[model samples]
Target: MRNHYLVIFILGLLLSGCVTVQLPGGKVTSAKDVEYKQPAGAFKEIASADADKSWISANTGNTISYFSECGGKSEPTLKDLENDAFAALNESKTLSSEEVNYNERAARQSRASGKLDGVPVELALIVFQKNGCNYTLTYGGLAKSFSAEAAAFEEFKNNFKAP
Candidate 1:
């Protein structure tokens, strides 16, 4: 009886060692190399912890910001990101939005008006998903001067590259 008990214990140990365990995959932090051209002219690169990249126009006080989100199990859709952003701005209104192609990927471009800190503001933004990441590039300024950097924003969006 003791021998039999010892054999059973050894078998249990062997079986446990042979068992394969599956662990969940690690979440992706970001792409290996995220590359994009800055907006043209007086837009100077600025440091921003919230954004992967950012630029400010000295001439107009307009700003361009780019940020990325790593798509884990629950990757967000373009509309989801857009709606969340618009919701954050007080009195936000979408002036125009359309589907477009950027870097050979489907993207959405939008023009919006809203208030920030009770000060009127206008925004132009492009949203796209690529390589397990969602990216947003936005240009914003005082409502009165938003148009000053509108063209540069277009150029910046056109030059974006996904890693």
Candidate 2:
């Protein structure tokens, strides 16, 4: 009947709407897999040697890591960096929470622990920022299985050069 044909057509249209085309390899692409290119000449290196000196002085006696990337220029002070790092660690639901303290000198101390490879390890990360520069010195344990992270941080700091 005409009604039956209309019903069949409507059903076919609805089913076609839900159909998804699979790629030749049966792989589904996700939006997150898309690559984004960094804008050219985006990051400039800090020019002052004194900035590096300040970072080194503030981060003594701690294993720290340094990473610099070409990005925005909203330079944060040592206090701001310390506070931000602490806030990030505090907000992590995976780690066991603990009290953290920071001094006026922009020194930080905290203890936290979490699972690593089915084993438990304690972690301590300290941060120091100096002279309101773009650099932040961070010392932390990735896991209790390894030793101090300060040496790695020192190596990273030593590699800083004005671009």
| Per-structure clash totals for the candidates | 0, 5
| Local accuracy of candidate 2 as per-residue lDDT tens digits, 56-163 | 111111222332222323444444443444433322322333333332343444444433333333333444433332233333333432244334534443443322
- Candidate achieving the largest lDDT: 1
Name the lDDT of candidate 1: 0.67
What TM-score does each of the candidates earn? 0.79, 0.30
Error of 2 at 26 (Å): 45
Model 1 over residues 57-121: C-alpha lDDT tens digits? Answer: 77766777777666455656677666654654578899998888876778888878876656677
- Prediction RMSDs, each to the true structure: 20.7, 22.6
| Predicted structure 1, TM vs. truth | 0.79
Candidate 1 — which residues are off by over 4 angstroms?
Answer: 1-28
For all candidates in order, the CA lDDT equals 0.67, 0.32
